[model samples]
Target: MVGAFHGHAHNRRCQLDWHPMYIDGTGHMEGEGCEHVFSASNKLARSTRHASVFHRHQTIEEHFAFWDTDKYAALSNFLRNHYREALTSIHTLTAELSVYPRLEWELAREADNQALTTIPVGDLNQISAALSQARIRVDSAYAKLQNAEALTAHVEMQLQVEERWAIGDDTYNKYKQETSLCRYCVALDELECLVVMHLFELSKLSLSGTGYKLRQQIGKALQRRSEAIQNALSCYNVQAAALDPPRPSLS
Candidate 1:
């Protein structure tokens, strides 16, 4: 690509003065012709170097050259702008995860209290039923938190994938091919695997620290209900004994 561009540039410079002469049906002049050829060759060489910059993996150096070459400034600006967008996405994902921990903490505290409740004095069956209901509710909340965390992790992964795509043609083609398994694919596969691992870690952290806290609260609520049921059963057992009719003089 570089060589092609250079040749094109050289051709353009050479043709500049020669074009008019050819159109006018005049032969080339001596001094003026030689100077035009020399200038055109230099311009061509510069253009070739500019085009080659994009193919180089040394982004920093290429970037510097890109800025230096007015002809290629537009391409450089495009890459820089896209990369900025990728950075913005990463920031947004981080902000979203920040709020999850607080919710988890509140849930955990509630669970802890439920786990410590005393049994009530009433219908044992009714108390037991209530406790069971409470347990169900706790489980539901835990499930919901898990799902939310999973969704957040998925979004984070997608953002990372987009970021990788922004880096270069390798990423672009990897995404484009979708199945070729080239070096870029291998790299992306590794990255995706790492992202999944991170997601798992995030889930664990949230569940263990925040979600777990909420679960603790829910567990406490269920425990309190169970105690209430046990008390009711005890009362019923006592009443049954007292209500027993005087046994007909046992033979």
Candidate 2:
């Protein structure tokens, strides 16, 4: 059988580009200068190894499942969703936070602007009341910010988080700086937007009731973001478990 198996393999290899035809073991084989002898049986016995003769293919994908990619992408997208106005918030809040330790002053600036922008004399008292609310919300926002900062620090420290989130950079170093900066910036925006939104809601209650809904959403999204991270981590852990090396059993 082993001899017949090799013979059949040899015949198949020889006839790869030609029509395959064969007769009883006594006949001449097809193609030019190809002749091989073999026993009749086509089965192999368990005593011998057949792999030494047959070649196979290997690729990086064959070794690693790609589930971690979706985990990172989903969380990154969740992170982005949590801070939709990150760019605008960064522009207004970075210096504000550095100098003021919170967004109360930015709200004050907006309050001042509100007085100037209105055609009729607006209630300076309403603006003042919103400023007070803004101060409270700012404190609430930074509390959430601390949680987000800790999560960001943890997510950034994971093994392939930065690598998976090259996020559109041209190199690994770029990946590191860009992901960290953008993530932290977005986190700051998420926090500051919370206060700005509260201020807007309180100050503009008479004008636009729903104008600050996005801020409301960001504030609520703290739970969503935390759940998203846990969900992603769960997926990563499952994939990792599949590839963990076997452990030696106690004797």
Candidate 3:
């Protein structure tokens, strides 16, 4: 009796794309171009090898898994998340610190203007007391702004540490190879450039304020010069009239 394997073989036949062959005991075949019997078997083996090679090439994740442990990748991922959180917090704190100082400056300017402009007909002691109280309040606000600036500095230092750790030399090189560029370094560089630009703008604003103050001082000097010129011209006119000859009486 034929077994199940024999029945399965009996059912198999050459497909439309395959050539059939019959071989004798002397190893000579008579069929459509079946010159060597082992060639078909060799082709089948080669096809299997090619399939395995293709599958191996396609499984890039598996290839990397064989060489790289997942723990390092996991740690890098965690560090990236933490670094993002820290950076965002630091940015917010920095913005607050920058704005707070400007606010205090505005308040101080307003207080000074009010103190200079307000006129009191009453006792001088009352006016002095009110001005002193206002100055104290402005000083307290300025101190608070200073404290915020210090806190922002501390946060910035912490952010710098984390940024360095996250994108160290080794990590930066590895990221360049893995992702074709160091995204963290790019982001940090962009932020640093922006901060520098902001600093430049702040410097320009300071210079502008100083220029305005200088302009006011120059205007006061010009007013004083105009008054001196008028006084000198009046004195010259009086001296010239006193020295004038009495030519009209002879005519």
Candidate 4:
């Protein structure tokens, strides 16, 4: 089974076949074994860069030996936390499923019923019936002329004010500023979810068991997402500048 983190990066169609969520007997393993060790040992590269092959090998072996001891020492605490997390996830999912316990056939039938209701009629029978009633009301002597005149005036006012408010108008500009502020807020929210959450996850990641190629892929993803972050930031700043009072732009 693919590791949870790598599996998430796969295409949605690919996930159905490979993701741990869809796979049985995978347990709760993140499959990040020894990645934490590899990340911490990056500093060793500087010291070993000039060393002989024997010394380099010795340093790596020593580091792994220490890492294994530390990992074993914390094994109990790790297992305890994972158990709690698994229980919490199971309970939450169970509650949600209970609230909306729908079967596949039920959902399919509901969708089919909705599709049938939406099918358009080719005739104007409904429209003709409505027009006939409207004509009768208009011909009635007791027809409320005052109410009709008020409605007409209201519609004219709307056309003059709401419909005619062009780009340069104050009302239009105010709404435009509001829209930009909304976009800025949405962008900030996305950044928080993507950057902050990913950073926390990466802090606990280990790449040792995942291989060098996987490490390179993760590195490239980091670089690529940095560009996306920059673009979002740029968009935020642009929107900020368009605000009514002009929001303070990010550095």
Candidate 5:
């Protein structure tokens, strides 16, 4: 199988035929060589070079045992994060592809129209294009409004409010709870994305052969990301606290 780095430069056919991710049973392996392991093990050479054969073997064994244990501890978290990432990618791609059919139909119609006659472009065409864009924006805004209204109506119905909804009333409290839950969920999603991105950036910094300048840049980027993560966490906590049964705050 092609290594993860080189696979990207290959043609689509080569990738499909040789990339580890595309190949069955490869699972999440990147198809890269053991360069990272070799680099890490190189650190042990300074201590092992003068040691006895027995001590060298023991040290190597101990090192790898610790490595394995650490990896095992993190395995579940790694799998869960990757699974979420895969699902997010799939969902995003599916949403993007949803437009393909309408686009194809539009293309087909245009082709048929062109085949019938060559149309001239003029002010009328520009007006029609502008109008189409305006219409699309209006439709999008209307959809958002409808969604908001539906959510409000659903909350109201669920609370079964017959009297005036005043502050501190049960109906008002339930409405706030619903809104708070939605905000909390949104904040949690944002926090997860930020954390995943921060970890991914940190991992890149750990890779062997990273230049000093690149490492410094990554350090600066991480500092900014840390601030962002803190802000997101604060937002999450605020939303969580607004819940009827307040959630425990994260550190």
Candidate 6:
């Protein structure tokens, strides 16, 4: 290809520029007039890439129908943002923690490690401060995830109950209508507050720590939240037991 272009260059002096172009690990000579050739190659490459055909959709419902149910299993908006934020904090913390090891901290243990590197390495107190901040972010994220999980469980229970009620015989339907003072509804409200509190706490957070101690804070909060969820579940279970027992779940 180079020889052909070089030979062509000798005679065809139509004000063309010559440059080396790499195509699929092979070298080729390109010039001004060779643009058509390059353009053709690009078109061919694009055609190959887009060769597979996909179904077209007429509506959003159609789009959702085409997608599998598992796509809906992603973390919902509330959880997704918090999850990503926590992940970012974790990433930064890991990078911060690894900096010393990555830059040979052991070799310069006695030296002013922070002063030696462009990236600031904190002293013990500063490291503790960064860790406290990381813990706050992590705790907030964990609480949000817990809240989401609880709410999802509540939603599933409500849906299941509705489905069972709707499918039951006329006698069961009459009982369901007559019995509206269920504790499960209150449980749902509690779950809603849990989710809302998670969101509210996130807004209240600043870059610095929440001034709360870090030791087992996430564990303690999760324990308390878990108790709340369990209390709700217990109430819901009572409601379920009162009903003509939920239908056997399909495998």
TM-score of each: 0.20, 0.18, 0.20, 0.39, 0.35, 0.22
Show where candidate 6 strays beyond 4 Å.
1-177, 198-207, 212-219, 244-251
User: Per-residue lDDT tens digits of candidate 5, residues 19-64?
Assistant: 7865556756787657667778898985785578999999999999
Evaluate model 2: give its TM-score. 0.18
Name the weakest run of 10 consecutive residues (lDDT summed) in model 4. Answer: 112-121
**Which segments of candidate 3 are over 4 A away from where they belong?**
1-94, 97-109, 119-124, 159-251
What are the clash counts of all predictions, listed in order? 17, 1, 0, 3, 0, 0
Task: Give the per-residue lDDT of model 4 (tens digit) for 1-251.
Answer: 66676777876556655666555566666666556566889979856855789999999999889888998999999999989998976864554445434574356445444533554445698667656655664564244466466555665664574455687999888888778889878877876766874684365347446656656656666777788778878877887787778888885
Using lDDT, give the best candidate's number.
5
Better of 1 and 3 by TM-score: 1
- Over the stretch 13-130, how does candidate 6's per-residue lDDT look in tens digits? 2212122331123222243446543544454442333233332223333434534354466538747876787787575455344433634433333233332232325698877776
lDDT of 4 at 229: 76
The digit string of per-residue lDDT tens for model 1 on 225-250 reads 45554554444444333332311211
After TM-score superposition, what is the CA distance of residue 46 in candidate 3 from its true location, in Å? 85
Off by over 4 Å in 4: 97-251
List residue ranges in candidate 2 displaced over 4 A. 1-122, 157-251
- The lDDT values for all models are 0.51, 0.46, 0.50, 0.68, 0.78, 0.49
Which runs of model 1 end up more than 4 angstroms from their true locations?
A: 1-104, 119-122, 145-149, 152-251
Ranking under lDDT, best-scoring first?
5, 4, 1, 3, 6, 2
Greater TM-score among 1 and 6 belongs to 6
Per residue, candidate 3 scores C-alpha lDDT tens digits across 159-215 of: 675554355587876654544224333433554554454454445444645577555
Locate the minimum summed-lDDT window of 10 residues in model 3: 15-24
